[model samples]
Target: MRTHKYRTTDVAVDGGTLHAGVWEPVETIEGAEVPTALLIHGITASHLAWPFVVAQLPDHRVIAPDLRGRGGSHAVAGRSSMRAHAADMQALLDACGAESAAVVGHSMGAFVAVVLADTAPDRVTRLVLVDGGLPFDVPAMPDLEPEEVVNAILGPTAERLSKRFADVEEYLAFWRAHPAFQESWSREVEQYFAYDLVPVGSSLRPATSLETTIEDMLDLNTGSTLTDALARVAGPHAVRDAGQPSVLFYTVPRGLQNEVPGLYPPGYVEGLLAQHPVLEHHRFEELNHYSVVMTERGAAVLGGPLREAITERPAAVG
Candidate 1:
């Protein structure tokens, strides 16, 4: 087994102080001068979600922060949203002394990367989004009440607020059996769930709340959040113009749990991808949403296409 060493730090950002995990490359690859990258986890996840990727990018310094209300840093002063999360990332980057670094985000973290690139373009040299880019295409989730949304965020493994499991083995078993994780099982997959919770009383609970999840889902300008951000990445655009420059989008052929089985329509991602002229889309034949981020193979499949895109960053344009 490969042991990964990381440091934990807390820093104040837009709304509150956040917990972050930092890992320096154990080995260096020739010609890869860049020493840093930020790993942003998806909704209901924390810094632990990026271990496989962090291990792969041994040449780059990696910083993984548990967004404001998830993972090790669950407490926050106020509600959480994409904008707030983006600002938190900026604070993390600044604290790490990273002037410019490549950023990789999965799921909701992918959306946060878009907002970060849009709001603080100078901080990011390149951006890689895994299974996230466009806004929620399922329309307002009126039928899904606030409590229902919260339940999903906690999952079945969570025990209470701000605390998770200390027993890594037990937690791993719970995660392996989860319907969302059924398709993804690997060492990285086990680690992904192991890091998401902190022990509380006799059980474990997620660091983030359903309220936080609901706020992000409803308040994050779902309509134009991604469309606008992608356009900025592509370059200058008129107020009325839509679409981004040099953006690469990757999607799984089958939607994740809520997206297709529980939430979005099958045609939603296809329709969204069509709007962006510069996006490079790759389709995975069998993987679902969670598996794409939870397993090593999932990350490899994503990293291959994304690496190609970064190497071919769009030419400088007026």
Candidate 2:
């Protein structure tokens, strides 16, 4: 069973139509304004990635949109920079009449959320960054190429997409075989897969264009304007991560596990928390990157620590 019902549509933003999905509260509490939440997914993922979180955020209207070129908003094209994605988020908020809302983001979406908060602090009432933000504190090796960082790990899956499969089932067979899906996938994740692909010329291709993927990698690493954007935010904030199945950086296969004692690096969220004294950090010791946002544990991660972080803010001075 789902936590809340959702609506889907095309929203005009930044000169093009972007696909957006929204889930709102079925019931409102007394004297509460019915908060709104804007969820931004990571690279290559769409609004579908948020079902688990949306279920728990039932009291607040939850909104998740395919940032520019992913999912149902495939026809749109852009440079795939985080700034552009942030701008699209702003427009989405405007269209929904949410002058300000709680912003929740995962992976690359976290990068955008930081940028949005930085760029338009007035427009964001609160922020929750999941498994991202605060750069990985690792040294760059001389031999490492940029592609090694972006495509190498998922290279097999990307290449296999070109092959013709009998149907979605066959494709899913190949997809499930990938190491990324080894642990387990839920029904929502399966539905996410269904919505992520579109049939083109008898072959099912992921809705995101290759250009969008490539350009995002380019923008995030070298031209990433987010670090500066995150610096400007001074408001209610929270950062959370699953402590197990570590997410990190290194040169070897399964390097994340071998790299360090922590999932990220020392001071990973420390710097941001230091800057914003109000920022709260919650680390779930048993979950991993994906499950941190997809499972029941994820709901608790948001509801217990994160929800308190946002709602417990001190009253503003007159």
User: What's the lDDT for all of these models?
Assistant: 0.67, 0.65
Q: Look at candidate 2 and tell me the lDDT of residue 109.
A: 82
lDDT of 2 by residue, 172-255 (tens): 776566444556466777788778788787778777766677677666666438656654443333222332111111111122
Model 1, range 1-318, lDDT digits (tens) per residue?
A: 343458888998766688999987655657766556788888788887777666566556789999987876777668787778888888888898887667777778888988888888777766776777565544445567665544443344233333455577766776666676776677666666666666568876665766677687654444576566667664335122232235556667445442343222347655655655455556665666666656677667666665555444433211
TM-scores for every predicted model:
0.78, 0.80
Worst 10 residues of 1 by lDDT: 235-244
Q: Among these predicted structures, which one has the highest TM-score?
A: 2
Sequence-dependent TM-score of model 1: 0.78
Tell me model 2's lDDT, rounded to 2 decimals.
0.65
User: Which stretches of candidate 1 lie above 4 Å from their native place?
Assistant: 1-5, 29-32, 139-145, 148-173, 199-203, 221-245, 258-267, 311-318
lDDT score at residue 289, model 2, on the 0-100 scale = 56
